[model samples]
Target: MNELERSVLAKIDQEQLARLCRQLIQAPSENPGGNEESTVLLLQSLLQDLGSTVHLQYAAPGRPNLIAHLGGGNAGGGLLFLGHSDVVPAGSGWDADPFTARREGNRLIGRGATDMKGGLSAVIAAMASVNQHAPHIPLTLICTVDEEANALGIEHYISTAEAAQYLACIVAEPTDLITIIGCRAAANLQVQISGASAHAGRPSDGASAIEAAAELVALIGENKQKLAAAPHPVLGPATWNVGTLKAGHGTSIVPDEAWLGIDRRLLPGEDPQQVLDALLAAARNRIEAAENLDALKLQIRGSVQMFMPGFLTDPEAPLVRQVCTTLQDLGAAGKHGIWTASCEGGFIAEHHNVPTVVLGPGEINTQAHQPNESVSVSDLHTAACAYALIALRQYETSQN
Candidate 1:
């Protein structure tokens, strides 16, 4: 490490930082309640210790977003490091306890290890480190909740008074140490199909909703194949999966209803409304062609559009330049690319005009929401060093 990098890393309290991360992982702030109060308080105290002003804003009752600011002077431009405190639910699989942070060999295992919390921890460490040097640029940390679900906390915060201040924001999402400049949008689609019901023995007596559902699923699959064959260049091609399907209630009766939940990831330039139009058209065609159907009906019941609005900062932008230089200066990973998966940065960028980038430590392929999810200790250390250097470089840029 160079003099600057070494100096920055030297200030990070590694043991204290790691302990905070573990304590948070043990809180089990999974969705439903998704209470981030405890974790937010822990971080709030750390920020206060660094001589920063802290504010805890609750979007809902228990869903709190923490903001802390540190400044040595007027600091011409502002920098916000964003992250979330809530984690996704830890379903069944696990060799070790999911909520209880377990350290073994060289990894820390937990639900949010790779998907987020580990990266969030690094930013906190970086904040503490920068505090020691008395940073010349004003720094703000926005740790929010509900990022794993609907990004309710961030959306609420941005729509309020807090978001108007920041000039630039970096979302600390797990990008495997790469600078994620952009991400494709994620959307939820619900397709409901209708048909008549009758006795199973008299097969010719009624229409089958299950049959229509099967046809719709097949049509969706065919559409996915077409999209794959002609993928988008920048954001990649639009892809989808039918995650949920439900049909009739009984084995002996002809099913009266069916529904499917489709998850679509839209590339940068794709039109979500057009995709819906096509899907409805395809479902109608397939259902009308059924052998003994009186009528085919379909409805686009619900959807959650992914909030990616296509943000790209020039490589020469002062912020981007500082980040690139920081990575190289610290001898950390030098790879840079936009992400294909969506993150909370999408919501923040669209709401507040701040140029947003997702950058952090954990690997993208770490099976984040699965059993025994873990983050490498070495990656965590490297991330702390990199983030600290980025903070320092941004301070230098603002001064110039």
Candidate 2:
């Protein structure tokens, strides 16, 4: 509510913000599709137009990430804004074309609109305003690819020495404008079990991978019970999910292979690899102890398909306070919360030791990944102002 904050807020262009949101939603950077290049290009041009120095780094061929720095940051560090370009597949059950962003009254409808594209657009628009009004504030915006499927883009980013200098990070995930100070981590493991094939008529003739897989599933259920006993105070307890199971070709033939998809949600201090190791070890022991099963002949191997670590920032942190204060000033209720879903914040927090906050413009539970995903147009405007004001105030406080 000072001169710079008021000026930056006034400078935000509402129509342009909505247009950019629609454009990004139309881009279709699906993670399973492995297409984030187009989204990166869109963001690169926008950031460049806003007077940011943009760098395009590919985590994989055709998978590009953008690192844009603006507002003349401080000597060694500055505020960082995190946005992921990739989105989950726009599955069936939409009222219209999922990729076609349709503005219906207050809601802008499309895939990625709620999950992140809306929030991402707000950040860019805020940076545009801030760049015009207050170019002296230091800010870095890193948009990564593949946050939905795997986190290779963020992994690649942290490996670079440039990540170590950030003072704080704001992940533009859907939070309905709530300021999230912590979130649980997510890791995906694909377990494949192999056994000798045989006819179902003779059960003892061949090892049944399906039967063994069932036993492991039951044991993992027990593991879930153990996890329920102890939960984190803020982010809640670690959890396990047996998301998928594929086995047996037909009713008459003994299946030769079994595939299992497991999802583990880790706490702030948990390690993804170590959790997988223990789960696999328990599966092996269960198979070994099972009666009439050939444990040595049966092979069970699993690997981490996607691993995202969790993060918890102190509620008293300046970045958290700034976001909350901004939210309150913008006529939105300011509160600290935790995200059950995973995002790129954990990677920045864990690897770079940056305090991370998740604040954005939409609803995660109701809108994100849902058909006809949408975000409030009003929420987008407020988010733009909030992001800009937070950056300006944070840098001012740091200087003081």
Candidate 3:
């Protein structure tokens, strides 16, 4: 490694990264609770102490997106490092406290340990090192809220003038150091079925909303087959899963209402709105068709609760290339890959037209949101080093 690179890497303290991770993990920025206030304050304090120009853009009441500039003093533009502070609710089955971070050898265990608090802390710690070593390297940290529930944090950001300022964006989403250049979009599509109710004893007296919902499910199942038939080589196929179903009150009383929640995954280049429109049309058609509906007096409604479109960055982009090379330089995988970006990488790439990548410590599928979630300190420090080098590389490229 060169002198500058060596010096920067030397400053990436694993202990400090772990400490920050613990602080953030303990903050409990759960989305459903709208409790990101404490987490936002904690990050704001850290950034201010690091000499960053800090500001908070409220995405919701008491929920804010923290913007911190390490070197570039203005919010106009820089290499944007994006992350979300909120984590999924810590559900049951933890051996100990989900909020209490504990170390087991090199792994730091807690909620949000892998899904992304480690990724966030790693990037912030890298910025701290760069602020000390190479203050002229322009960096913008857009730490957002509500990445876990709906992506309102990033949604709010893309609506701002500052969103278009970034030359590139690096999403601090865990990829276990694999360079992610593309992602599959995810969305929540719900179907609400309403029908007249009557006594169950006289079955013909009332239309069954549950039966209409079943027809909707069958329609999506046919769609699922077609989607699975066509697949993106890198990011995989457009897909669907029936995750939730809420219906009925009593077996004796005919059900008046029913709800079905379907999860849709779209490939890059697919418009989320177009997909929604198609599904809505299909559902409406099925209801309108007397043959399919069997003359059931039912109203089936479809709505998109959330939609985060996928993105595919050019592998040749300078920042993207730098990210891959930096991972290799840090003695990790330089492999290019794709993500289902549960976070906002896709939002930034699609809406703001920013070249974006998700590269960070820990495994997304294996560790994120699981009981006893954890990430290795070794991985955190390595990721920090890579973050630092990538910042230096961005600065050097801008100079050239």
Candidate 1 — what's its lDDT? 0.74
Model 3 regions more than 4 Å off = 74-76, 284-296
In angstroms, how far off is 215's CA in candidate 3? 1.2
List clashing residue pairs in candidate 2.
73-138
TM-score of each: 0.89, 0.96, 0.95
From the highest lDDT down, the ranking of the candidates is 2, 3, 1
Report how far off residue 314 is in candidate 1 (Å).
4.7
Which has the higher TM-score value, candidate number 1 or candidate number 3? 3
Residues 1-400, model 1: lDDT tens digits: 4576577688776666667678768767787567778778877887788777888888988888987887655332477788888877888879878988988877888988877888878887887776666566577888888877767787778778544656577888888778777777777677777667789998567778787778877888888888898876656677888998888979889887888877788875666777777788877776677666655333323344434334555555666666666677657656668676777777677766777777887776655777898887777777877777776666565567
TM-score of 2: 0.96
| Model 2 lDDT per residue over 1-400, tens place | 8787788898887778899999999998987998989888989988887778888988999998888888775333577899999999998999999999999998999999987999999999988888787777778888998888878898888887464666678898899999999878888989999988888899777888998899889988888888888988878888889999999989888888999999999886678788878877988899999997888778898999988877888999888888898899999999988888888888888777888999999999999989989999999999999998888877777788
Error of 3 at 265 (Å): 1.6
Best by TM-score: 2
- Model 2 scores a C-alpha lDDT of 0.87
User: Could you tell which candidate, 2 or 3, scores higher by TM-score?
Assistant: 2
lDDT of 3 by residue, 173-206 (tens): 8998898988888998887888878898986778
